[model samples]
Target: MVLHDLRKYSFWGLLSLAINLMYTKIIFPCALLVRRPAHIRILGSYSIGRGFTSGPGLILDVLNDNAELLIGSNVKLNHRCHIGVMKSVKIGNDVLFASNVFISDHTHGSYIGDMQSNPLQPPNEREIVCGNVEIGDKVWIGENVAVLLGVSIGESSIIGANSVVTKDIPAFSIAVGSPARVIKTWDKAVEKWVAVS
Candidate 1:
């Protein structure tokens, strides 16, 4: 049993070293350790801090040349997480994202502005509307969560799985549901999470 455990650990350590070398040569310096099959398409300016790691099948796309994407240090994104940016998307330090999470800062067309999209025009050709997204430090985003444009998730907030966040989430709050609403808040007084009234 001991020999088998040692072999398993050795294999993993060697695999991690190989992956790190590949990333150092092919990807940016911020990719400390990343699993295989990551599709990163960058046409914009970006910066990723130290100790950043991503799981397999991660798609990070920055579509526009003027767009900017910033990811802080010690962030981990699980498998199949997609972040598509056309404007600006800033993620703070110590953020953790579960699998299959989608975060985008732009939509295909605008319905509220003067240059509204026409049905006659193809959806792909329609003008894109940009709304920057900001995720504060120490935020934990669950699996299958879609964080849309113009949304700001506050620091240390917890977003439940399968939730669609459309608006701002306050700091130290737990939010859930589609168009996620805050259900619990960290009570600093009691040093615990309490129901939000």
Candidate 2:
């Protein structure tokens, strides 16, 4: 009886191992092809399902419980995007995100660092801030854009490269500078967009 149980467990273990290997090499690359030019920022692509749809490489952390959302069908995510997906963050379709884009939903569980001093040392945690971050369809997020928590960017808007977004921005608006102020909006009547002129 013990021999039979061992065999069964070994079979299960091998199956799981095969499955993991398949996703890392085969399934993931195929998904990326579905959306050409798009890349993924992963939270836990191996075990957890936090990753992109059809794109390039992604980075995610399992211990932190951070999730990654796909930008669009075809997007490119450069390296070093610190996405805090402990909460919910959604990106729309046909968007382009530059390198070092911070799409975080939660700033560490506490205000102070969560990393302990030593293996046995206690932790110091403060209030948690978890909110939803949504980027609209066909939006462009520039490099070094620090998107704060609980902010929603409307559809068809252009976010200038290296801008800081603090509050919610309306659709078809051109926001730039620190704290990302809405300089103008897209005017279909004039066939041209207007900023705060």
Candidate 3:
């Protein structure tokens, strides 16, 4: 399974390496209007669906493979954000993404099939297998952050901007740092979520 996925993402990542951002100005607005979403605003050249558009610097790559990158209503992806979906990535309602955020369901590179020219060979592929990336309701993903594969961020969690989440985060927690540890817990009564001591 891992080998299969490794080949899947690596192949597509190279295949769909489009750097041109010119299509957004013309192709995006019409796609959204045709789809008729509540809101849409695209600034960069992202291969997007009809329902994607909000804020500037939002860059989407390889949109055709993302049959699973589902965005909820009132959710906004800010500028310079990258969303990569290989398997399934579901976002709940009212979520916000600051600048330079990245979310994906699968690893970017994997080797799942035989690299040699053979019709039938053992799949010599190493892959980072993950279930999915599910963002719960009212979540806030900060800038320059990477949400890795098989990572489930709980509902109402505030991921510190520019952090990398490689594991599952529980609900109502504030996670930060490279591996994104639970730095603090959200205290509804304190009028502010306190960091985990």
Evaluated with TM-score, which candidate comes out highest? 1
Cα lDDT, all candidates: 0.90, 0.62, 0.65
| RMSD values, in order shown | 3.2, 12.9, 14.0
- How many residue pairs clash in all the candidates, one count each? 0, 9, 10
TM-score of model number 3? 0.61
Candidate 1 vs candidate 2, lDDT winner = 1
TM-scores of all predicted structures: 0.89, 0.63, 0.61
Candidate 1 clashing pairs?
Answer: none
lDDT against true structure, model 2: 0.62
Clashes of 2: 9
Model 1 misplaced stretches (Cα beyond 4 Å): 1-17, 113-116
Q: Give the poorly placed runs of model 2, Cα more than 4 Å off.
A: 1-30, 33-58, 61-71, 109-124
**Candidate 2, poorest ten consecutive residues by summed lDDT:** 30-39
Sort by TM-score, top down from the best: 1, 2, 3
Give the local distance difference test score of model 1: 0.90
TM-score of 1: 0.89
Q: How big is the positional error of residue 110 in model 1, measured in Å on the Cα after superposition?
A: 2.0
- Tens digits of per-residue lDDT for model 2 on 1-197? 14564476577665654454456456465333222222334543232222433222344432234544444554445545555565667777666677677776665344436742342334435335667788888787887888877899999887888898878999988898788999989999997887577
